[model samples]
Target: MRTRPAGDEEGAGSSTPPAPPVSLLRSGRALLEHIGPYRWRIVLGGLLGLAGAAAAVGQPLAARALIQDLGRHDAVAGALTLLSGLVLLGAVLKALSQYVLAHAAESVVLNARSRLTTRLIRLKVRELERTEPGDLLSRVTSDTTLLRQVTTQSVVSAVTGVLTLIGVVVMMATLDPVLLWTTLAVVVLVGAVISGVLPRISRATAHAQAAVGAMGALLERTLGAIRTVKASGAEERETARVRRAAEDAWHRGVQAAKWQAVMGTAAGLSVQLSFLSVLGVGGARVASGAIEVSTLVAFLLFLFYLMEPVSQLIQAATQFHIGAAAVARLREVELLETDDAPPRPTRTRRRSPAGRPATVVFDKVVFRYRPELPDVHRGVDFEAPGGMTALVGPSGTGKSTVFALLERFYEPTSGRVLVDGRDILTLPLPELRASIGYIEQDAPALSGTLRDNLLLAAPEATEEDVHDVLVRTRLDAFVHALPAGLDTPVGHRGTRLSGGERQRVAIARALLRKPRLLLLDEATSQLDATNELALRDVVVEVARETTVLVIAHRLSTVAMADRIVVMDSGRVRATGTHEELLARDALYRKLAATQLLLPTPEGFTKAEASQG
Candidate 1:
């Protein structure tokens, strides 16, 4: 599917570095702009890195001077004082820069983390289905975190190494142009070796991270159905599956490490080679009495300064690859447009306006799960006016499919969904959904306080409003029985509430919306005999004011409906009042005889658990 860029209001915080032209690894340098806001501070901390390198390099120069000026009283005090100050400055700057680097990298990582989180929650259902949950979680966690490490350590190292290397080259050129040329040639060779090894490191790092995401996905799916896993006794089998994925990650990490180690060793050895060349050439010049011993020592001390930064540079190069791999993984999600197309704040119905209450009309709608699967709905047409309408069909015959289309969870492949005569597709889903309340088959309530669940559709509702819903849905008794009415915790999926009670609570939530349309799919699963009658009474009363479309499994829902639309194989077989359908349709009679819900006992119907 095609997607537009995230609009200005929503699009922020996707900074990743561009490729570096001279990197040993093929991974490009991260762009300064894309280094994110946090990496900027890391760069600042790197500036102080020069001060630290100066002190270490200065020590050798000071040693050379002290020897050359031995017994020269004038040189002693000045050299010692300069050395002392350099040491002090380096120590202070080193501590400050390290703190700044760590803190700045953390802040940037946190922002990326939050952005990924918001995107995940807001992404369309279709997107979520396409991507692995485990991989997404890994991006939010492992991958983003690895990028943080690069910002703090790798980024700082690379900057400092470049500065120190420049300082060394300048000092060497001043000392002797010939020696400088020789050292630079060696630097080129070392760089070539590092370059050759880079692609392997990046590919390994990326693959390793992906393996970790795979492991996380496997665990999530298996553990999510732990009960089923145990009942089926497949624990050992699942464990082995995860172990294999983890092993793949381990192998990839080791391969990356091997390449990094080679680059590190090459950097360290290059320093020694340059140092050796300088010594041999300088010794011959000194033997001829053309160069002073003191000068050679000072330049050699400068060379040591190159060693630390060069090694750091090599390590940073490795980390650069890792961060790039991570960026590629994250870009897959970040680049997608998350904000759904703007739906109208208000609906535009397709049906022409009338004085009558709203009507939900599907005009010759066609739908298919896939191109290969024949249309589940083939130019099927039906209308549910404002009042109770029961949708009846045998299993696998599009009874539930009607609810899916009405809720706009899936649009009909062809034709239009018109509510109050306006095409629903034109309406903003959130606003459209807010106007049409849906109560699902299981009466699934989120894990939160009872009051929170009741206000799922409308949080700003008052206590009086909640109480009124309670009385109407026959939940007053449950409220009175609870230790804390409306405040009791409903465990995940309302496990704390019995099946019937859960159903009533869901109904209460729908009523709170004062919706123009209420679509219920198995909304009365938990209701016993008398409670079913009370719930049916509530639905019928609400239908008087608004449209109510129900997929009825029980006679109470059928009896309560102003009309019944019988469906079979995705087409409407007949439509009329209950008795009218019973007279005309064979399926309606069999359904009523077998599935009608009898009313509950009067006193027992009121025996509900109190809210707490």
Candidate 2:
């Protein structure tokens, strides 16, 4: 086992500094870009909303005609019919516009989520390792939801509200300039208060969103290791930690709600104050005979109707502030580094052939997980020439780091890693990875059917290929015992299977890929004696077809390797056959003695040594 250095698990307790706050202008531009695809639909919705406003405006004029008709004792049926038509038309247009905008909103959210997920999958390993999985998950799910309203409905609402407000003001001015001026005074005062409140809403919403992400991270952390928590009797402790996170989220959410409530109240107050001032001044003007009773009634009707545009404008601004926070969080994810290399063209199953065993070389390699951490590989030099090579060492000897470097999961600090005599950095990532299969220590299995886990690496593999690999890994009997055989659900992380079964399944999956190089880290650790012996034989057989690089502590497995490399303190100390190393290397001799693979001084015999 390789010792994990400090900062290796930084994401668990600490994270990179929070990204700088995104500018309002940049966030606004991002929102607009999200809306770009649905611009035509949004335009149609806005046009319909404007038409609805036009109909609403005509209702007041119709009411004024009706009032004049009533005062003159003239027939009023035509005036009543016109007012009813305007009301019905306005309602129908508003409904149609709302439906169009709602549909567009859902589409926008889908696209945003798809793009974010795509970017996340391609992000560099370093970025992923240093970020909480749950936090990234929240951005894909919750953050993208905010784009729905801001991208379509809020944008159209803002535009229609401004246009309608202008139209209402002009008509009000025509009715009575004195009353219009009086109404403007109240609106202007309220508008200034609302402007101040909007920024605070943005800031509050950003904090609230961050707290929600933290809560999600805590929940994910607890659930991911529920078995360990239960076994250790720490259920209550973990629950309390998650509960505290949830409480923090709740507090931040309330803060945002308070600011939003203030904005809402200010918007309503602006309309109410304008109505009172207009009524008082319009009444005085009517008394002076400057305007007719009908004109005063129509102007008052417009003042009441003015609330629609005012509320729309305020609502648009509020939604934008809320969405800007989500945009900033989303932008932070976008800024994380991603693999820039284009994937190599995939070969068709029929056209592709089996890969030749690859030669691997680590030339003066040096590596550290982070610049602040101590070096894991200190100018280590080694070579494996297409055969079974076993790396045996004490803990913290940089054994696992070699596989990581080979997979290009992390770059070497100041040296070269070559596969088939070519620098790995110069190869396309997909192409390089496709030729290598790595079975990690834990041997994790995804949540799916047995067949799904088996074909994960080789999706193009045939049913015959699956069965052949299963037999090689001695898993055919286990699959036959399963209720659904290959179709059985594996459960989360293959909890349904035993530890040894998961390891064999992982090996079978990797073998199906027909990789040129197979790297195994403690592949036999979970197995019983019977299964371990079986797997050892399978590995030896596979080594004849491809390069097999294994890290093992068990002398039983190491003894079978064609060559054994003794490693210590991040450097290769010796390379030779097991018998040759036992005769020459001090570390190899002690290690074999510990496993009882070699005879001890006090009790040793040829028969006992041969059996061992």
Candidate 3:
């Protein structure tokens, strides 16, 4: 079994996977390009942010004028009136600007969401099986949310902050060049410190994002088997598992917080140093008659204004870390080569394919779950034409595994699986899968109306086709009892339907496909006699027109199969009729007597008595 991450400071140890870092700028550029459809909104939002920043700076300018004209009472009243108007105007513009920026950011988030979802669905089944469902969900939900934050606040603040920083710097130069140069020296030192810490902060943030993904995987695993967990009384163990993953996440978060605090405080201290340097130098220059008092006061106030931008700059930089972290997760999925699943290309819709019924042949085929291990289907050879065939085996005999290989979920490690003389590996997934209708034992029911579940197998199926299967499978009674009939909600995984009803639904779905080959795995495993009889009728109806390869369990189902192929330990052990195998194969006879044989209509009373 593949084990997920353990929540040990395990990472706190000497050897762990280095945290994913914000190490790729080219990837960042690619992200922007992919998200570029929302550029108009970003542009409009940026304009508003500039207006808001300018309005904010207007407040201090008005204050300076108010103070300068205080000695003249008439001038002071006029200055006070101007100040009130500027204040109200700035407030309104600031409010409107923030609104515009926020709304635009939301549009960016929406576009990103659509693109990610599209990418996810297009991924190959091989990858989906290899990847954890919860980790993928984290990318879709949590990482995308972080990306939204970056576009909204960080983009606007970065624009405004850079402008404000420059505006404040120019104002100081006019007051006294000597003081301005000293402040620049201090700013340079602070910038160096911030630069040194930024990579570490970004690295930690990326690890924090990955840790969230790890936690999602653990939660999904536990929740997926909640019934089994409860039955086994393993709730506390599962909880501890999740808690450990969460704690690992907490540690990564603490790493980011530590760096942020150190940088933020340093920014504040740097601003204070710049202010005191200006005040002392400007006052001495005024005393020496080299600078005017009013000008010095105005310059120091502008120096105070610079602090806002410096703080915004720091925040913008931190946002970069978060954005980089999110994009890295997104890219991990995006960069993976999609499985050979494209919707049946619209350009070619063949009225009649060259092959009528598929002739499947496996030529010395071999497969394994791991490349380093021995082959599961070791040099297997098989042939099945356009008719009914059965795969029968004991547990772990790789009967179900053969069906998986035929479906192309796993490729042969060597040799070939073929359809109509063409190697199956040569066909695109959709093209090959289109010709085969597969009914799994689980009989999965998607959350939707009954009609939706049925049509999923054949989206273009007609009403008459649906009605035929419903009646044939004895689902007509279930439909008539439900008020909404076909439109009635099935609930998640079709919990509202009984196991037999779910199996019938799967049959109805497969029936609609009009496939060249129908792959049925003991579709009636969960049903009683009455339901089993109805499904047998459905299988007989389907086998008439298509090749039916059934994985048989009960002897009743085995009796219906045209031929039986028995497998053991990944190799075919016997191929014969039920009577022939019962005489010669002791293993087959044992399996039939115990696990495979089902009581006939008359023999049921006797079989039930023998067990008692």
Candidate 4:
């Protein structure tokens, strides 16, 4: 089983797969829930839309009257002038209404994307274990864009189309009841075709969007390690991998387009059939003298008007189906569990004496990343009684796992981790993590100003506290040399700074928090002899005030530890002061000789030794 850097789910002997996706209608409704806060605006837009449809309906009725008035010789010219003026006014009002609805549609998109962005940032770390950065980014960007199209264009058009359809039907009935029956028959057929085709559109769109996300994930993985690929002469291989994903996305998109084409064809067919049936029946009525020529002409015009709204309604439904598919992708990320919220402070939290440190105990801990995999920590037991304690072990001996468990990033399969006589699990996550300062082997930094990186853990830290930590960590000179000083921008992952500088920056950031227990994992691995010595002094000095736990990679870093715990094969072999352990433990002596020294012309020299 592959394990993540922190929280990792076990690959069990048996595990049930997740349930199938929710229905498109249910997913569409869930997307609409984001529009609740802007309902008033949407309602206003809808009213304007209805007014536009009302104007559209009135146009044909006026044209029918104009034709009949032209046949009459009485005040014919005057009636034509009035009719022209009314048509112009209706056109202006319709344009204004459409503008208002367009604005409301944009606002809905903004609100939804904002909420989705917030959720993405707060998601729990474990979710990252199962997710890809590129796929998550695609959902945030392109999927949200599709949702915008649905909310603004599709939903608004649907509302206006329905209103126009109703108005056209009313006019048709007034003109002739027999002709209206023919139109309703075509409407029923159109509705049935739409219902069948909409599900197909939805399924195709879902597959297409998923393929796009896969393409994004592949591209992201490649570009993130571009240098490695080039160094290993694997660029051509990686290019082919991304090309395959892109081609897959294209194929899926073509499938969706085919489904949409069928829906569009159905909509057009309904309009043509309705027009033919209306013309056939209306011609018979006029021939039998049941309605006048002018009335039959008006009924035929209304039938043509029905086509516009019906076509729009069908087009809007197609857009909605596509949007619903994208909504499902967005919901997958938005529905993920978020990190633990801040806990209320309680009196039960342990507070030790001045100049002393918090006690840490690992009690019979047994943990494996996966249930089907071998245990990383097997019935482990150890204790650190404050002061400075160094944990020495060979690589893969679970030194880093101890730090992860202490931070509560993942719970042990069984056993308890106690801090100052209190179960760490009983403490709220934020509170437990806040009490301990952890510096990983990489000492990761974000893209930001030096001041921004330093103040991340303690945003409220004052300028004096910042200067104090900088001086203690030996970063003061480096910052002072810069033109912008603390305000200087640190390039991505602090690439602008040397490895030692980056390590010191991470240490300074943690120090500003004033944690009771400090866990340093290979904190000085990147530093040169001079910088390493300076950082060692800083660690020893800090240990006087708080408990310090060091996962020692170099023996020189922990030579003065108050006590040293030597571990092998996931269990502690011995614990004592550094010198005492060196004498009593064979593993300790071997590790010290390898990590602390090298043979020189004079003898074994600690400074000139290659690091173990």
Which candidate tops lDDT? 2
Give the alpha carbon lDDT tens digit for every residue of 83-164 in model 2.
9999999999999988888888888898889889989988987788777788889889888998887865468889999999
Error of 3 at 343 (Å): 2.8
Per-residue lDDT tens digits for candidate 3, residues 281-324, read 88899999988777777777777777788878887787777778
Between prediction 2 and prediction 4, the one with superior lDDT is: 2
lDDT of 1 by residue, 1-612 (tens): 111112212111111112222332322433232365665677678877777876766776676777677745555777777778777888888888788887877776787788778888777654665555776898899988876777765778888888887877787777777667777778788989999987888877777777777777777767666768899998987778777767766877787788878887898879889899888887887888877888787777777776777777888878887787876666666765564544544544322112245699988888876555667787777888688888876766677777777777667899988987889888777667767778888787799988999998877677888889999988888888889877889887677998888888889998886788888987886789788878788887788888889987877677768888887777777889987866666666666655554343233222221110
Candidate 2 residue 171 C-alpha distance from true site, Å: 1.7
Give residue 37's error in model 1 in angstroms.
4.2
Worst 10 contiguous positions by lDDT, candidate 4? 10-19
The positional error of residue 441 in candidate 4, measured at the CA in angstroms, is: 1.2
Full ranking by TM-score: 2, 4, 3, 1
TM-score, cand. 2 vs. native: 0.94
| lDDT (Cα) of model 3 | 0.75
- Write down the worst ten-residue block by lDDT for model 1: 8-17
Please report, as a residue range, the 10-residue window in candidate 2 with the lowest summed lDDT: 10-19
- Candidate 2 residues lying further than 4 Å off, grouped into runs, are 1-5, 8-20, 340-347, 350-354, 595-612
Model 3 stretches astray by more than 4 angstroms = 1-18, 55-66, 71-97, 344-356, 573-594, 598-612
**Which candidate, 2 or 3, has the higher TM-score?**
2
